[model samples]
Target: MADYTTAARPYAKAVFELAQETSQFDSWSGRLQFWAALVSHPDMSERLAAPGLTHQDRATMIEKVVGDEMDEHSRNFIRLLSENNRLPLLPDIAAIYEELRAEAEGEIEATVTSAFELTDSQRDSIIGALSRRLERNVRIVNVVDKDLIGGAIIRAGDLVIDGSLRGRVENMERAVVN
Candidate 1:
């Protein structure tokens, strides 16, 4: 079987393109989030998975769960998924849709782990540096790890800058071993 992400990609791209064309990123994002959550609930998951229920019946039940929040586009999307028996991919579709939206907006999320909690000024400095380095707007997520032993590790997408004392010591150990 193909991976769920692979199967869900085209659907996510379709929804993303539609959302982009209609200038409805926020709307589609919210709708996807809601449907994903609804599909993920254990009780609803069981009902959707029930082999006894026909596709239309399952779709109707799922639509009712969504209530009035679903506009026509949402209703049609759900109906299409139900008819195709692709409803199980809702969560992956939502996540991929968000990633598409984020990429379109030219944003990346970054995280920094340090030996101690970062002060406001310190965080600002890091974001500034990352923005300059990456040449895009940078959002920072800060984490404290006392074991880092007095410095930080920065992760910005594929780029990782390990400046921690622990990291340096590990590198030194590797150098001696080599």
Candidate 2:
């Protein structure tokens, strides 16, 4: 797939700045997510790609569907995207906007993949450790993967801690081979 993230960055940053200036982070976040989902729908995607619809028609259709949910500024933003043929980039923009929002709020989301489900105490412990280490509010997303055999692999931003039993065995195997 084409990398839309690079093209979406400027738009995401612009929206993030606007949200910050207006203290509307949550509102914009929700709007972007909604728009992304709307545009990503198979029917909507097909309609958008259809040659019969002019940019104005596409924008109008979206506006009608959104109705009063969009404020003047949001409506203008949507129009700008339509004019630039960037409506398809909403998912990337929303994702990047969320990253900016999380950074601004001093929060980070972590994914923990393990062989078994984590107990409440274990989850709490992982959250506490990650919060302390990262010096930011940490949100944990737990995923169970039987392939891990045991233990867990924690990922937060660029940092990864691979403590899975499968990982250890692989390391040992590699060491013995080399």
Candidate 3:
């Protein structure tokens, strides 16, 4: 896993730099996202890893699937990966690319798991609080976790703040057990 991540870093950084230079950050992001989605699909992963398929065939498939959604540069990059049998790396590459893009934009992604749906104002409040605490723009990814019981658990990168009733109960249980 570490080796793959290490090998993927350069490609991700190169793609990120090219995207930044071309002023096509959003387009490149969308292209990578599409590629990630495609490559991560179970059937597509099997096809990509199939021993009998030729690189040319894989490249053609990618082009066919993404022709309208991707720019020429993204297509060329995909073709390069196909030639090198690196198509399997697309999902990791996309993830790293997004990480770089977010860092460059002074933004951090936060996962907000709540027992119930959050209103627009509540979402805004969470974002505001996170931004104030982290001193960076916060992009919240909201998820509904019924088991949370009540309130929310927020994760901003490595830092997590658990505010749910389930979490509080767990802490209390631990204290009592100890």
The candidate scoring highest on lDDT is 2
Which tens-of-lDDT digit does each residue in 30-61 have in candidate 2? 99999999999999989888998888998998
Runs in model 2 lying further than 4 Å from the true structure: none
Question: Which pairs clash in the backbone of model 2?
Answer: none
lDDT of 3 by residue, 9-75 (tens): 8889999999889888988888888888998899988888888888888988888877676667777
* Inter-residue clash pairs, candidate 1: none
For each candidate in the order shown, give its overall lDDT on alpha carbons.
0.90, 0.95, 0.88
Off by over 4 Å in 3: 1-7, 40-47, 64-72
Error of 2 at 4 (Å): 0.9
Query: Using TM-score as the measure, what is the rank order of every candidate, best first?
Result: 2, 1, 3
- Model 2 error, position 146 (Å): 0.4
Q: Pick by TM-score: which candidate is best?
A: 2
Clashes in model 3: which pairs? none
Q: lDDT by residue for model 1 over 1-178, one digit each (tens)?
A: 3599998999999999999999999999998988899898999999899888888897899778778777888888998899888898999999999878877898778889999989999989998998888887888888989999989999987999999999999999999999
**Residue 122 accuracy (lDDT) in model 3:** 98
Model 1: runs farther than 4 Å from truth? none
Q: Which candidate, 2 or 3, has the higher TM-score? A: 2
